[model samples]
Target: MDDARRTAAAPPAGPGTGPGTGPSVGLDIGGTKTLAVLLDAAGEVVAQARLATERGPQGVVAGAARAVRGVTRQAGLTPADLGGVGVGVPGLVDPGPGTVRHAVNVGVDGAPLHLSRLLGAELGGLPVGVENDLNVAALGAAHLALAEDGPGEGDAAGVDLAFLALGTGLAAGLVLDGRLRRGVGGAAGEIGHVPVDPAGPLCPCGQRGCLELYASGTAVAALWPARTGRPAPVELFEAAAAGAPGAAEARDRYASAVAAAVRMLVLAVDVPAVVLGGGVAQLGEPLLVAVRDALARESAGSGFLSSLHLPERVRLAPGRVPVGAVGAAVVGRRAARPAPAAGDPRPAVDHQPA
Candidate 1:
């Protein structure tokens, strides 16, 4: 794939019009790397690649531009010969302003993303769109989480959705009444740093005991120190599965923290199904079963919630882990649209950034 990536399409030239040709570009700027994919209107990946993120905003932007250009070349298309270019980042993004208020890994803080400008300067005026990664994941889950046409059709249709990303950081996105909520500051779904343990450990937010302190991928790495440790998280989970006592303790600690976080989510967002994603969520059924059990017991006002048809079923997302990026594409191509009609349940995803 690496060698094959050497051959791809060039992003569209300027701004051109034609029949729908799928999202012109979809870039997911991850903490560790910047990833971009080009797809046709049919949601098929024409080209894709990942670039190692260097330090500072300039480096990040340059690396990202290279990725966008590289993938575009692979697809034999220009930026103008397609739909919108959607990007999903890792920080508190002010979608209205395109300002990444602060980003730990991407080396951006209060930086204006003027993606249109980036596209103009970097890709010859390609129409670019942006969104936060976690929100994109929720959008991704909302669309694909629905059961394929089946006997449970009505039940699936009426279901509300939510998702949590338990990766390096903790964050969630909520889709209510069949719509994505970007919230006032565009951080509505970000409660990961709400201090679940005030007196416990210090959080990346300069505070102590943030929910993420106990539940995120970072937390897992911290909790199970690498060298002196039995092994890293992946190995630890394996050991736990094999009935290693030490691994069991580590797993329980992780589960307990996740349970507390899950309880908070159940109470705050009354969605029907909570889909878990991200690196840590890859534990699959073990994580879900633990979370489900915790919610059944620790979730407050359980009886009341059960009465209100709340405490939605907790489940794992249906697709591959990278679905979050796909969600980001949806955010650009569909979810960012206007609100649905009063009684309409399907999302009205037409607002593809004018």
Candidate 2:
């Protein structure tokens, strides 16, 4: 989503690395929609499908199946030899067993069973692993950043990485020492619902002024109407860019809230690098410059949170864009690897079904 910041010494793969030649499919399932990419073994997308999200849990699963089938057909492969399928969904996901503990927006609770358990048979027994969408996005970004900073064909660099998704809510995925930390019950990076302002506004979780309401795309849209008669952030951004009085005012408020969000994330996480992704990050320079300035002004004037250094890896995502589905697919490869054997090199990716 961060097109401008993505440009770097590392460019995305050329047009040749599509389906049947790479890792197969990367499926990202969101609260309102689902997308899938058919990649060859080379990790390049051969075909992609975006499906309108449906209501009802079964309807959502059915929609996902439809997308999977669409991409498989495009790739000219049957489900039988399709390596593996990775699904990235919102909510708490257990990476150990690839179980979906809960998907609040997707509407499942108390571990409604693993999607892989039921869909496994249909997917040619391919390893169907589920993961927290943000975690997968982090993996994708990590791979890109590693490739960008390292020798050609980006191997994991030693740098720790944090990927933040700013959408209807806020949350982050962390990577250190080339490994992802899926905390206890898989709730580590679930920052969006965390209450940041206890006395401000009521949140879905019965808290006041959660980070989501103040720093997400939803937050920006909510402030849009007050600044300009229009309620759309995209329109509001354009208005601000054009120097429309109301739009500029609304953006300033949004910037302040977002800066606070950034401060909390950077100061607490203490990572050397952080990359911003999601629909809201598309605001481009407005967000980039505002955040950089905010952190500078606030951090320089304060002693607390002053210990965190200016990040070396604080650019936006690369041109290919960071999508949870691609992240999920990459994770599928990792989860499928055989358990570490004595003295064996780490098998980072596995295409065979579990």
Candidate 3:
């Protein structure tokens, strides 16, 4: 019915039955937009929808419900036919409590927002999994990486990957051996708050010189007004490409900070690859080139750093598909699947991030 729905081949049946046997929904809630993707059993997207994000906790929850319904309707599916729903939010999430601890952009801070309860009620008790947005994006990235490399034991085993997002904020998603890692307190990849300089700039997190303050798209746009009397990140990048002095300096600094972040991640976890995603990642090859050059400069000065091969590990995520939404779908699919019985010898399902 709606233009957003396009017919795709039906997914093949697998281990499950009943409502959980059909397609699942994945929702990615960002500061500005919300994306809903209907994913078939094999994780391929069948239909999708998008809407401007609503402000405040209630509005956000309502918007998410509408998105789910919109995509399912487009895909010719009903709530009862849905397998599960997975949501990715931008702030701190406690999966056990099903709450978003704080997300200023969506107007929830300090006060816990019970997103799962609200969304679950709206969906009439559908199984829902909620996780940090970047973490699910990491899962989606890992899935893409494995898909491109082909299915094999060695290909799927010991797969260590990271998804770096550089949008309004900077953070990472880490997947170790095909499992998402949300460290103690569920803040493993909050690399944006990592102190990069003592005298750089103040961060809202009550820290000075945080990595996000220098490298995030928000930071870049903030610098643009002072340099070119405009506050647009796109214009800033354009100016840098056109050789504007101030814009060039700002661009180079952002690239250097991102390179530093990559180096830190590599030295810390030594993931084999890092997929760059998020709104800022739309800068594409130019941004990738800048980061590679910066990493190269660092490796040139230190033999220890050179051994890390940072440039070889960094890559831009596919810009065409919404990685976060796709990852959330994977999360929902896993959540809906029945757990293996005791002594079944199959690995337990891991859905920590959301």
Question: Of the candidates shown, which would achieve the greatest TM-score relative to the real structure?
Answer: 3
Q: How far is candidate 1 from the true structure (C-alpha RMSD, Å)?
A: 5.5
* lDDT tens per residue, model 3, 1-354: 332333333443232356446678888888878878887655567777777788798898888888888788776677667788888888888765568977887777878899888888899988787888888899778766766654342445456898999887899999887778888777888899998888877789999999998778888777776455654666777889999878888787778888988988888899989888877888889889889989999799899888888999999998656888888877777667676688864332242222
User: How far does residue 77 in candidate 2 sit from its true spot (Å)?
Assistant: 3.3
lDDT of each: 0.63, 0.64, 0.78
Is 2 or 3 the stronger prediction by TM-score?
3
* Candidate 2 least-lDDT 10 residues: 1-10
What would you estimate as the lDDT of candidate 2? 0.64
Q: Give a tens-digit lDDT track for model 1, residues 49-69.
A: 666665466766676667766
Local distance difference test, candidate 1: 0.63
Alpha-carbon RMSD, each predicted model:
5.5, 6.2, 3.8
lDDT of 3: 0.78
lDDT of 2 by residue, 120-215 (tens): 556656667677788778877776665455344434535467787777777788876567766666677767777877898899878887888887
For candidate 3, the per-residue lDDT at 34 reads 83
Residue 75's lDDT in candidate 3: 64
Q: Is candidate 1 or candidate 3 better by lDDT?
A: 3
